[model samples]
Target chain A: MELELESEGGELVVPVELLYGITEELTVTVVLPFRDPFENGRLGSVGLRAKWRFATRFSPGRADAVAAVGGITVPRSSADGPQAGPVIIAGLAAGRESRRWYYFAGVRTAIHLADEGNDPGEQLLLNVAWGVRPWLTEYLAPDLVLLVEASSRTEGRTRVNGQTVDASGGEVLSVAPAFLLSYRNVMLKGGVQIPVWEHLNDAGRSEDVRILAALELHW
Target chain B: MNRTLFVLLAGFAFGVTPAAAQDAQRDSTEQVAPAAHPDIVMRVDGLACPFCAHGLERKLDALEATETVEIRLNEGLVLLYLRDEHSVSDQALTKAVTDAGFVVRAIERHPPTEGTD
Candidate 1:
């Protein structure tokens, strides 16, 4: 089990996750999120995700792998109100990693089910990342890595009681520079995401700079 | 206050004391000692990050025969020291590595040096 706290645009989300390895190539994770603890603290949706590494190529000190990812988020009521419905998520990820450098790309989609005459729409997310290790160190020593990621998000139109919400859907592209530091079983990761481009259907609040920091421990 | 905390954490993450450095050296020497050579050495692929590699260590440690596990990140090598009179099979080692989200590229077995048993 690992606990992670993520903050975006001044909102805090704490997610507790448990991972289970079912086979040599497959793993599953369960995540429960708690949002807005500093204000109207409440529980968010519970999610389950599965990843299967279907293809792999290995060399002496490098490897490349492609994984199929699928997941579902169960809607739950929060301090504000109940969510529209459950969300089904699916995606594919491919990455290559060596002793000094790493690269990754992934695409994911989430389809939100309608409930009580409300449809929350679908979302598509794409991400690409590059990483570098400044110094190569053995185990038990502190290690640091630097990474930069680019992402794009697009959403479909949302409906309420058969009416399309004009400002409900749009697209945003962002870039983030991050760092990962680790020693033994503990890790610290943090980043700031800055929106570079955006297009909305109607007038709405544009996305601002977002910050995140997380600490993880494996036992 | 938050900035100060971040600076402190960063310092801790990048700093290593002399004692810790010596311990790390000793640990590596123990694995390669003539009298105490590791029983198994595995070359693992896709081990890019130190933080993510902990899973591989945990999986290997779960084996009944495993006494100590040391990793060489640059070479993608994992050295296993086993308990007395205990043994781990190649299949088991491969499975452990795979379960930790890595592929085992090669495995080598080394017998204890003479008169060291």
Candidate 2:
């Protein structure tokens, strides 16, 4: 679930996701995010994500992995906006994990597949996160991990009927801090994103804060 | 709202210490090779939570030889049960765990003990 307050309005999202590991090298996930912007509630979008691990290096105390992620997001409701259809996303992620700390970096981009005379904003995403776990134990204890991340998004211009409507789409950055807690097959994570910088065209809303909470059940 | 988030961050900063880490490494040598219906135990690092450990389970379960996979979070151990007529090498175990984003400190193979299904 996510709650975001922006200069224009507020939005809430409840997303259900199904993830499966097809093999040691491949994984797939499907997500359906329910969205509510103010009084109207509707299906936001459907998305599919696939990740392929290309390289992994392991040692006694540390491990590093590199993977490529590809996905597609399709808007489900007209409330989405013009230039809304299927957007293909691709990215590469690299991470290092140890007993105490984990860090990851990734970059992603959304390429719009829209009809003629409709221009939707393409999105670019870059993110880096670092997390640390305290209290390594020999018995059953709830594991807790604290994380901090920097996320940046760059949006292109929006055009309607082949005409530019909002040119103020550029870049926005946020600093998010989060925590994870888990016992066995269940995990919970919560965080808040605070805007740190912006260089945008007039088309995008300035966000106040983004609150997030997620739960995962693994078999 | 920002203050609330900052307070949450500070709360975490003061909550725990790194001294609680589970860093026990077992000796892999002197262990017998796995028999039919093998039971494999491995010590792992970076298994801080169930979500992270789930990756290891998924990878191990994908093998045709694996019948079941179990993770003991606190002990940082993964146990795999193999079907009869199939076996997994230590190198394969290491690669699978590493690909799942964790490190294997040691791996041991054993015959299925009595009462262990």
Candidate 3:
């Protein structure tokens, strides 16, 4: 998936992670995250994941079946912005592999707690991934994947810093194009997330380009 | 008749040139020494997919055990080249990778290959 520790400008914004699933399928995941966007303070939270693996029942090869995952962000974190809580979300995902090609798709809706009395915290997100690992030889291989996702957001009228502005925001559309190139087990992942479209009352200064990079190793 | 003679001489020169070059290369290859580093093979669990593979490598980098790292995805194992083997042991290496979020299935001496020291 295309995730980022959202860093725009050079402000003290909480680093956002489009990151998830540090563990394998059908297992519980524990995420201890600290920080919130614009809070300038440490916000701590945890999560749990349960995969369904449904497609496993009918796969001809080593299919991962299907998965249903649900988790909640505790109220202790920021009660505002993208890291809203107490939030709950459930997702249904399915994946399959045919030789060199690996495919996956999932849809999720997060019910975040109310914010600014207008509910800018409630949203729904859907994402999909396709990857190809071409094995050139016994000691060399390359992995490539693409992801597409969209989210619906709610923004209430409010004032930031000190501007009495009527920020009647609604829904926003986002798209991310990601690429991962791997040499054997060591991989380099990079992606760019752009704001496609959104029903914003006033998307102050509009959004800017965001990016991320990470190195992964497999044994 | 002159063109044919020239062609024959050219063919003869080309054939002898490759043989002479091959003889010299073989002599140099035979004189080179083997590598000095040993192989570290580690079998691990919780490494069944791409996401974990990424995170596992990040975790392994945190250890700073040796310099170079080689991961075998299909074989579900990792190999490192350490200057001194004591810097990381079987159990210690397993715990580091696991703490970064992976399971250690096996740890053993990698069978030496022809050029390893």
TM-score of each: 0.83, 0.70, 0.48
Q: Model 3 chain A — which ten-residue stretch has the worst lDDT?
A: A54-63
Q: Please, what are the lDDT tens digits per residue for candidate 3 over residues B1-117?
A: 435533543443233334335433543542353135435677765444443354555465456555445565566667666544335656667666756555676666645432222
Q: Give the lowest summed-lDDT range of ten residues in model 1 chain A.
A: A75-84
Which candidate should be chosen as best, given DockQ against the real structure?
1
Predicted chain A of model 2: TM-score relative to the true chain A?
0.88
Measured with C-alpha atoms, the lDDT of residue B60 in candidate 1 is 92
lDDT of 1 by residue, B63-115 (tens): 99887888888878999888878888888898889788788988888873322
Model 2, chain B only, scores a TM-score of 0.62
Taking the tens digit of each residue's C-alpha lDDT, what string does model 2 give over A1-219? 122222224666667688887876698988876666335757667889999989977654466889999999877647566445688999999998766787999999998876656667889999999999876642234678889999999988877677776664688899999987764445667888888998877634565788777665555
Question: Scored by CA lDDT, what does every candidate get?
Answer: 0.79, 0.70, 0.51
Return the candidate ranking by lDDT, descending. 1, 2, 3
Misplaced by over 4 Å in model 3 are A1-4, A8-25, A34-45, A57-64, A75-85, A114-121, A133-142, A146-169, A182-187, A203-205, A215-219, B1-117
* Candidate 3 per-residue C-alpha lDDT over A95-168 given as tens digits, one digit per residue, 9 for 90 to 100: 76433566777777776565434243345566666765554122323445444434334444444333434655
Scored by lDDT, model 3 comes in at 0.51
